[model samples]
Target: MFAKVIVDISHESIDKCFTYRVPTDFSLSVGDPVLIPFGRGKKKGYVIGIEELADFPEEKIKDILSPLEKEFSVEKQLLDLAIWMAEEYGTTLNQCLKTVLPVKKKTKNRTKPGKIQYGNPYPAPKLNAEQEEVLFAMQEYFQEEKVPSALLFGVTGSGKTELYLRLIEDCLSKGKEVIYLIPEISLSHQSRMRVEGRFPGQVAV
Candidate 1:
C-alpha cells in the first residue's frame, strides 16, 4: 500500500505533498497524523490520502516512522472545515491545519508519567420548571433535520452551565462529540475545570 502524506513543512516551495510506502502489516486511515522521514530528519504529517499504487518508483518512497499515538485523528469533517477556513480567512492550509492539530510536547524523562488528575463527577441538581421547559424547547429544535446554529443568552448567575452540561450529556449518550469554545481567556481555566469535574475522563483538556 502507499500513503500520500501532507508534510508539515511550511516552506512555500515544499508545500506540496509527497508519497510514501506503507508496510503490509501496518494499518492506517485517512487523517491519521504520522511521522515521516523527510531528508535527514523526521517530520510530522497527515495521511490526507492513501493509495495502492505510487506515481514514483517504489524504492524511492520512504516508510512512515509511526502514527502519533497520543494525538487524535483528524476527522474528515474537520479537514473540510479547515479548507473552508483557509478560503474564508485567506490563510494558508498549513496555518489552518496547525490550529486544529495538537502540538507535540517534549517530556523530560522516560519515567512513567503520573496519571491525569480527575475530579469527581459534578452532582447535577434536578432541573426546575423553567429550566425543564427551556431544555425541552432546545431539544426539539435540535431534533429537526436542518437545525440552525443556536444562540443562548442569559444574565450572569443564570443556570447556563447546567443547561450546557445537560446538553453535553445528551450528546455524549448518542455517541457525539462536543466543542465548547469560550471567548474570554480568564474563564477558560475555570470552565475547563468545571467541565472536567462534571465529565471526568470524557473531556480532552
Candidate 2:
C-alpha cells in the first residue's frame, strides 16, 4: 500500500509541503527526515505526516529516499504550538516550523562536537547573605506546585549573572533544561561565552 508524505522545502520557500509516495516495504513515521526530489534538484526535510489514500493513482508520485533522522524531530506539543503561532502571527505553518528549528550550519571541522564548552577553571566566589537568601527563594519557587516566572530586577553590577549561573546549576542538577534570554546581542554573546567556558561541550547558544 502506498501513502502520501508531506515534507518541508528549503530556500526560505513558503510553499514547503511536497507529497511523496511511501514504499510498500517502508514503515515511515512523522518527524523523520527524508531526501526527496524538488523541481530539478533534491533537498532534505522532515516528514510532517503520512496519509493513506485509496483513489489517487500511485504512479504519479515519487518515492522517498532513505530517512536521515532516526527520530521525529518535531514533538506533537511543539507542532500544536507552531500552529497557534501561525494563526496569531498571520504566517504559514511552514514558516513557523522554520523559525523553531535550528539553522543547519556547514562545517569543515567535522571532528569538533557541536556543543558549547565552558572552560572556566577558576573557583567561584562565596555567596553573601543576600545572595544566599535569593538562591533559597529560587529553590523554594521551583519546589512549588504552580509554574512560575521570575523577574530579576536590579542595578548594574549587582551580580545578576552570578545568580543566573547558580540557578542554571540548580536546574541542571535536577535534570531540567534551561533557556536563558538576554535583551542585547552583546550581552547574549557574553552570557553564551560564560556558559560555554563553565560547561564545555554541553551547551548550545
Candidate 3:
C-alpha cells in the first residue's frame, strides 16, 4: 500500500500531499505521523490517505521510515471527521484538525455508548394507503443487512414524523442504534420533543 502524506512544508507548496510507499508488515493508518524521505533529507509528515497504487514511479517512491509521536497518533474516524468538516465549512485541514484535537494534550478515554433503548415506544397511528405503501417498502429494505437511502417527500402535516417513529421503533427493536441530526438549532426543540414523546429516555437531547 502507498500512503498520501501531507509533508510539513510552507514554501511554494501548501496543503499538498506527497505519495510514499508503505513498508510491508507496517500497519499504517490515516492520521499517523511518520518520517519519510523528502527532497535530499527526511521530514515528518501526516498520513492522510492510503491506497493500493503509488502516484509516482515505483522506483521514485520512498518508503515511510517509521511512526512518530505515538502519543499523538490520531484516530482514523477523527481524521475522517476533520476532512469532512474541512470540506463542509470551507476551511483548511490544519484548522479543522486543531479544532478536533488540540496539540500536546491527551484526550480522556470515553466509554462507548450503549445501544439506545426505545422504551415502550408509542404505536404508530393509522396511515393512509400512500403512507402504508411507503412504510412497507422502507421496512422491506431492513430485511437485508444493507439498507439503501430513502427519501420522504410530502407537504407539511403529511404524517412524515409518524413514518419516522415507526422506523425508529423497528430499528430499536432489532438492537440497532439511531443518530438523528438536526441541521438547524431552531428545529431542535420540536424534533427532540417529538422523538422523546415517542421513545422516552432513549434520546440524549
Candidate 4:
C-alpha cells in the first residue's frame, strides 16, 4: 500500500504531495504526522490519502519514517478551512495552519499566592446617560451568535480603558481568554502591568 502525504517545504516554496510506499506492518491513517525525506533533508508532513498507483515505478518512491504525532492535531472542518485559505491566499496549507494555530511554548507553571493586588484600584467614573445607553447596546450586540467588529470612537480621557477592563473581568470570570492589542510598546508594557496586577498569573502579556 502507498500513501499520499502533503509536505510543507518552505514559505517561499509550494507544498508537494508525494506518494510513499507503506510497509505491510505499518499502521497509518489520514492526518497522521510523518517524517519524510525531501530534496536534500527530511521534513515533517501529514498523510492525506492512501491508494495503490499502478503507473508509478515502485523503486522511485520512498517509505515514510516514524510519525511525529500519534493523532491528527486538526479537526476535519478546520482542515477544510485551512485548505480553502491556502488556495485563496496562494500559500501552502502548512503556512495557513501555522497562521491559524497558536504558537506552542514550554513555560514553567507558577502558581501565585493569595489574592492579586492592583496598584491603581481607582473606581471607574460614573457613566453618563448616553454612555450607559451605548454600553447597553454593545452588550446586546455581543450577545448575538457572532460578535461584529466594533470601533470605539472617543477622544482622550473618555474612559475607554476602564470599559475594556470591565469587559476583560467579565470574560475572565467566565473562563475565557482575552488578547489585548496596543499600538505603542510603552503602552503595552503598562497595560501588561495593570492586567498582571489585577489577574496575577492568569493574565499573560
Candidate 5:
C-alpha cells in the first residue's frame, strides 16, 4: 500500500503531501505519526490517506522509514476537519493544521466580510428548470464539503452565463467572495465587459 503524508514543514514552496511506499511489515493508519526521508534527513509527518497505487511512477516514490512514537499521533476528528479545509480552500494540510488549532489571542474579529452585488445597469435573466437544477446540485454539494463545485457541460449559448450569474447572486446572498478566472489576457477585456455589464461598478477586471 502507499501512504499520503503531510510533512511538518512551514515553507510554502513545499506545502503539500508526499507519497511514500509503506514497508511490507509496517502497520500504519490515517493520523498515525510516521518518519519519512525528506531530502538528506528524516522528518516526522502525519499520515492523511492511503491507497493501493502511487500517484506517479512507483520507482520514484520514497519509502516511509518507520512509524513514530504515539505521542506524535494526531486525533482522527481534527485530521478529518483539516483534510476537508485543505480541499476547500486550496491550501496544504500543514497550513490547515495550524489553522485548526485554537488561537490564544483574546480578541476575535467580529467584522463581517464584504461581498459584491449586482448593479442596476443590467436586468437579470430568468433561467429554465434545467438551469435551476444545475444550480441546485452544486448547492447540495456544499452541505457535505464546505466548497461547492459543479461541472456545467453544454453547447454554446445554452444559458451557461446565466447560470454563472445566478451562482454569483447566491454567493453574494451568503456574503461570500468569488474568484472568476479567465485564461487568456486578450479575452480579459471581453470577459470583463460581460461581467461588468451585470455588476457595473462592483467589479474589477
Candidate 6:
C-alpha cells in the first residue's frame, strides 16, 4: 500500500504530499504521525491518505520508519481544517498544522475563580432608524442556516459601538461566542472595558 504523507517541513516548496510504501505487517491510518526519510535526514509526517498504487518508482519509494504516539495523533477534522487553511491562505500545509498543533503556554498566575456569564444576555440599546435597519439586516444573516459575515462601516461617533454591543448581546442570547476586533491600540482598552463591564466574566482581552 502507498501512503500519502505530508512531511512536517515548514517550507512552501515541499508542502505537497509524497508517497511512501507501507510495510506489509505495518498498519497506518489517516492523521497518524509517522517518521519518514527526507533527503539524508528523517522527519515526522502526517498520513493524509492511503492508496494501492505507487506514484513514484517502486525502487525509489521509501517505507515509513515508524508511527509516532498513536494516542497523540492529530485528529482528522483538524487535519482537514489545516488543509483548507493552507489552500485558502496560500501557505504551507505544515504552517497551518503548526497553528493546529500550537504549543501550550504555561500560565504564570492561576486564574481567579469567577462565575461564567456566557449565556447571560445584555440589555439592548435604543437605535435610530438607520442603525436599526443595518442591525436588522445583519441579524437576518445570523438567522440563516449559513451565516455570511458582514463588514460594518461608519464614521466616528456614528453609533457603531452600540450596534456591536447589540449584536454581541444577540449572539450571547443564542449561546454563541463573539470576537470583537479593534483596529487601534488606543481604542482597545476603552472597548475592552466596555465589553467587560457589559459581559462581566465572559470578556477576554
Give all candidates' CA lDDT scores: 0.79, 0.66, 0.75, 0.69, 0.76, 0.80
lDDT tens digits, residues 88-145, model 5?
Answer: 9888778777655433344333434542323325567777888889878866666474
Q: How high is the lDDT of residue 7 in model 6?
A: 89
* Higher-ranked by TM-score: 4 or 5: 4
Model 6, which residues run further than 4 Å from truth?
70-72, 102-140, 152-205
What TM-score, over all chains together, does every model reach? Answer: 0.72, 0.68, 0.45, 0.54, 0.45, 0.60
Off by over 4 Å in 4: 49-59, 70-72, 108-139, 142-205
User: For residues 69-169, could you state the per-residue lDDT of candidate 2 as single tens digits?
Assistant: 64346665556666677779777776666665545664353334654434444245688898888888887887877866888777998777788888888
In candidate 3, what residue range of length 10 has the lowest lDDT sum? 114-123
Candidate 1: global Cα-lDDT? 0.79
Q: Report the Cα lDDT for residue 167, model 4.
A: 71
Lowest summed-lDDT stretch of 10 residues in model 5?
Answer: 111-120
**How do the candidates rank by lDDT, highest first?**
6, 1, 5, 3, 4, 2
Candidate with more favorable, higher lDDT: 4 or 5: 5
CA lDDT, candidate 2, residue 98: 68
lDDT of 2 at 140: 82
Winner by lDDT: 6
Q: Where is the poorest 10-residue window by lDDT in model 1?
A: 109-118
- Tell me how candidate 2 scores on lDDT: 0.66
The C-alpha RMSD of each candidate to the native structure, in angstroms, is: 5.4, 5.2, 8.9, 6.3, 12.8, 6.2
Q: Between prediction 1 and prediction 5, which has the larger TM-score?
A: 1
- TM-score-better candidate, 2 vs 5: 2
Which model, 3 or 4, shows the larger TM-score?
Answer: 4
On the 0 to 100 scale, the lDDT of residue 91 in model 4 is 83
Query: 1-205, model 1: which lDDT tens digit per residue?
Result: 8998777866656656789988777789988889899989999888878998899788888898888877768788777676687779876666667776655565352334643233546678888898899989898888888988988788897788889988898889989888777889899777876887789867754
Candidate 4, residues 1-205, lDDT tens digits: the string is: 8888778554545475688888787888776678888778898877767786724899998888767763345545556666788899788877765544444566554556753344334345688876777677776776678787988777887767766776777777877667666778778656765666666666433
